[model samples]
Every structure is written in structure tokens, then in C-alpha cells.
Target: MNKIKAYGTESHKDDLKEMTIERRDVLENDVKIDILYCGVCHSDIHAAKNDWGNSKYPLVPGHEIVGKVVEVGSAVKDYKEGDIVGVGCMVDSCQECQPCENDLEQFCEKGMVGTYNGKNKHTGKQTFGGYSTTVTVREEFVLKVPTNLDTKAVAPLLCAGITTYSPLNHWNVKKGDKVGVVGLGGLGHMGIKFAHAMGAETIMITTSPDKAKDAKRLGADDVIISKNEDEMKKHKNSFDFILNTVPVKHDINPYLNLLKIDATMCMVGAIEPLEPMNGGNLIMGRKRVAGSLIGGIKETQEMLDFCGEHNITSDIEMIDMQDINTAFERVTDSDVKYRFVIDMDSLK
Candidate 1:
């Protein structure tokens, strides 16, 4: 084991502070990363505050990690020192499950180990995440990052990128498809970019008219102010797919109404209970509403490779590790342009 420098909150109400934590030594098939940047995700705030009721204290919460490989175990053949790699929301999973066999380890029947606040299978200890200078992960769970993109901006792609990418890929969104992205936060922003890149006529559906110009700048073909009755009616039953990225409970029926018959709307955010919907909304159009988690390891790598080919990365604001408290507040207020990335060197 090695004592590594990190920043974490000791209690739910306490602010994050510098501390030292233990990371396991590199074992066979393990890769040790010298973390360069880690993205600040809204889930980090939720976990830090124990809002989900499943958080563990002394929590180190960052899952969107990117860094250089400093060491690789003897059995690791796919990566070596100096390679840029990433680790997303998951670190490990039971490989024997059907989901794992299917390359969908995110749905591991035994439960995928989260990057933070999850139990380590090997050490029987809680897994600490990327709010630190270094991390050691299995080779299978580590991702090969594209060198073309700026590494700092690429950090959020580990989580936010993949979360939005997977659903689009799964639903097979195609060229010229009419795709609607609900909300304009981190997840929603990525959804728009991915949909547009996939050749969809991407539309940004939001209640704020002021966000329209920004949405167009981010690859949205058009913007629909959801609060405008005439505007919402104009797009009714016109969408081939919708990626709903709203992070809080809200009425989804309006968005559901936008889908064409047999079209689907996938929810990638708002893990909490939502307002009850009328079943008739679905029964009438044969529209479907589903949910997706972050992609599995294989798919995450594909998403990164896709991003690399397309020169895609998140629009972000950089912050020092010490500024996390204020960043948390800003994130809660939706004050960021899109994403926040931490320069881990500041933790030193």
C-alpha cells in the first residue's frame, strides 16, 4: 500500500480538505495512474452531501479521471508507462455475470464497483476516487484516451461523455434523424454535441430562451423553448429520439409527446422519482421512455475513440483542488458553462 495525497470531506457537512489516503500496490494486471486532471461531476456533489442516502463518509468523490500511466503490471500488455488513460464511474465488476460477458459490465449482476464510495473486491475496503494525485486500477477497467484532444477538457468525457454517448449508440441514432436533447446542463450539453456529430438534426429543448444562442454554438441545430405552447406544438410527434438529461424531477410528459410513434426517449439523468405520467401518453403514440447508465468499459473506449476522430471534448472551466467548495455551490446553481475540471497538480 502507498499513502497518496488527496482532498476529501471527512463529514457530510464539512468542506473538502487535504488529506492522505492509502492506495493498493500495483498487482498483476493493475495500472497506476499519475492523475493529471479530474472532472467535477454533479454526482460528486450528491455523493459528498450524502443526498442519495448511499454515501460513505470521508468520501473522495471524482470519477471522471484522466492521467498518464506511470506503471503497469507484468500481465498488462495493452498499456505501459507514458500512456494517457482514463477511468470512469466504474472500476471493477464481477466478470462472470452475463452482463460482463456481454461487455456491459456497468450492469454487472453482482454490482459494478463504483470509482468512489464502492467496496474494493481485492482489499475489502472502500474505493477512493480521482480527487487525488494518483489512482491504481485494473487494466480491463482503464481506458485508452485519444492524444489529439486536450487532456484537461477530455476528463469529463469519462463520465458525462459516455453517459450521453451510450444511449445514442444503443438506440442507433442516425444521420438526419430529428433528435431532441432536454435541458442544457453538463449531460444535456454533451447529448447535443453527440447527437449533432452523429448527423442528427439536433434540437435543444429548454425553458430558457437565453440559452438558444449558446445551444446553437454547441452544435444544436435549433432551440425549442418548452414553455412556449406554440413552439412545443410545432415540434409535436416530430422527434425520432430524445435524450432527456434533466437532473431533477420534472414532468416528462411534454417531452414524451415530442416522440414519433415507435420512437424512444432515454433518460440519462434525474435518478430520483419523477412526477407521475399519464400512461395514455405512451399508449397513444407507442412511444417508449427508458433510462441508461454510463457505458461499460468497452463502449467507453469506443466513445473516446469517436471523440478523438471528431475532435470532441467538453467546454469547461478549470479550477484548483482547493476551490472545490465554491465549485460545488456553482455547480448546484448551474453557474458553470458546462463542466468543471480540476488540475490535480494544485493538490500538491
Candidate 2:
């Protein structure tokens, strides 16, 4: 193991500060990365503050990583030094599970290892994440990123990008289908881009009238104010699919009322219990509500390739490593335009 510079909190009550963390030495099938950018995620705040009741202290919270290959172990063949690559939420998993064999390691029966605060499969040590200068990961978990896109903005694609893409791809959202993206933050913005790229009539559903202009600029064909009862009723039973990206618990009943018969709305955010849902919402039209997690390595790679082809990237605000604490506060207050990405050069 090698000690590296990183920013993390020693306890739930403390703010992030510089510290040393250990990363495993490159193994025969491993690749070492010099992290260039790491995107901030809302989960980072939750984990850092122990909001989920399952967090470990000394947490280095970042998973949307984009970097350059700086070293490779003897057995590494798919990547070389100087290759642009990425690492998302998961770093390892039990490959013998049925899900892994089917390219769905995110659902591995033994549980997939998270980028941070997860038990490492190799040494049984806690995993560290991309808030540091470097990381060494197994080749199977490393992804090849497209060089054509802005690498900084591409960082969030590893997380926010895939979270929105997986559900649409699974439900077969296509041209001529009417799609609604609930909420207009990090995940919702990407949802609009992907749905538009897929040729769907994308609509941004939000409670704020102020978000309408920005929503349309992000590829949404139209906007629906969820707070406006008249607007909500006009679009009822017209949506083919809805991607709910609200990160906090709120009532989903009204959104449910807008789905067509046999239509579905998939939740990619709001991990906690939501307001009581009305059964009549589903019973009336055979509508369905579902949920999705991040995609597997194969699907993540595919999502990146798709983004490359279409030149899609998250709208981001750049910050230095020293400003992470302030950035965290801004994120919690919903002040960022979309996402925040840390430029690792400050740490170097």
C-alpha cells in the first residue's frame, strides 16, 4: 500500500481536510490512475455526515472519477499509460455471481464494492475514493473514456450520466415516445439530454417556473410546472415514461397521475421512504412505479461511448480541492447549476 494525500472527515461532525490514505499497490491485472477530476455527488454529503446510518468515519467521498492511466501492472492489456479512463461508484464485486456474468455487477449477489466506505475484496480493508491524487483499480472495473469530450465534465457522466441512462435504455424509451424528467438538477439534466438524443419528446417536470428556461436549454422540448394544477391536468395520461430524479422524499402521487395506461416512472434518486403513494394512481390505469441504481461496467462504458458520439456532458462548476467544504455546503442548498467537479491539480 502507498500513502497518498486526500481530503476527508475524521468524524461526522468535522469538515473535510487534508490527510493521508492508503491505496493498494498495482496487482498483475490492475491499472494505476492519476486522477484529474472528481465530480461531487449528493451522496458524498450524506455519507460524510452519516445521514444514512451506515457511514464509516474518515470518509473520502467521491466516485465519479476521470483520470489518465499513469501505470499498469504486468497483466494489464486493455489500457496503457496515457489512456483516458474512468471509475464510477463500484470498484469491485464477486464475479462468480449470476449478475456479474450477465454484465450486471451492480447487483452481484455478494454485494458490489463501492468506491469509498466499502470493504475491499482484495485485502479486506476499507476502500478510498477519488478525493485523492491517485487510485489503483482492477482492469475489469476501469473504463475507457472517449477522448473527444471535455474530461472534466465527463467525470459526472460516470455517476449522474449513467444513473439517468440505464433506466431509459431498460424501458426502451424511443423516438415518438413522450418522456418526462422530474426534477432539474444533476440527474434530471442528463435525463433530458439522453431522452432527447434517443429521439423522445422530452419534458422537464419541476415545481419552479424559473427552471423552465434552463430546462429547455438542456434538451428538454417543453416544461411542466408540477405546482400548477391546470398544467399537470392537461398532460395527464400522456407520458410514456418518466424519470424521477428528485433526491429527497416527496409525494409522487401527482406524477403518477400523469402516466398513460401501462406507462412507468422509474426512480433514480430519493433513496429514502417517500410520502404515502395512492393506490388508485396505479389501479386506475395500470401504471407502474419502479427504481434503478447505477449501471454495470459494460453499460457504463456504453453510456460513455454514447455520450462521446453525441457530445453530451454535464453542465458543471469547477472547484479546487481546497474549496471542497464550501462546495459541499453549496450542493446541499441546491445552489449549483448542475454539478461540481474538483480539479485535482490543487492537491498535486
Q: Write the per-residue lDDT of candidate 1 for residues 264-284, one digit (tens) a residue.
A: 999999998999998999999
Error of 1 at 170 (Å): 0.5
**Model 1 pairs whose backbones collide:** none
**Cα RMSD to the true fold for all candidates:** 0.6, 0.7
Candidate 1 positional error at 63, Å? 0.4
Name model 2 segments beyond 4 Å from true.
none
Residue 154 error, candidate 2, Å: 0.2
lDDT per residue for candidate 2 within 220-264, as digits (tens), equals 999999999999999999999999999999999999999999999
How does model 1 fare in lDDT?
0.95
Estimated TM-score per prediction? Answer: 0.99, 0.99
- What's the CA error at residue 99 for candidate 1, in Å? 0.5
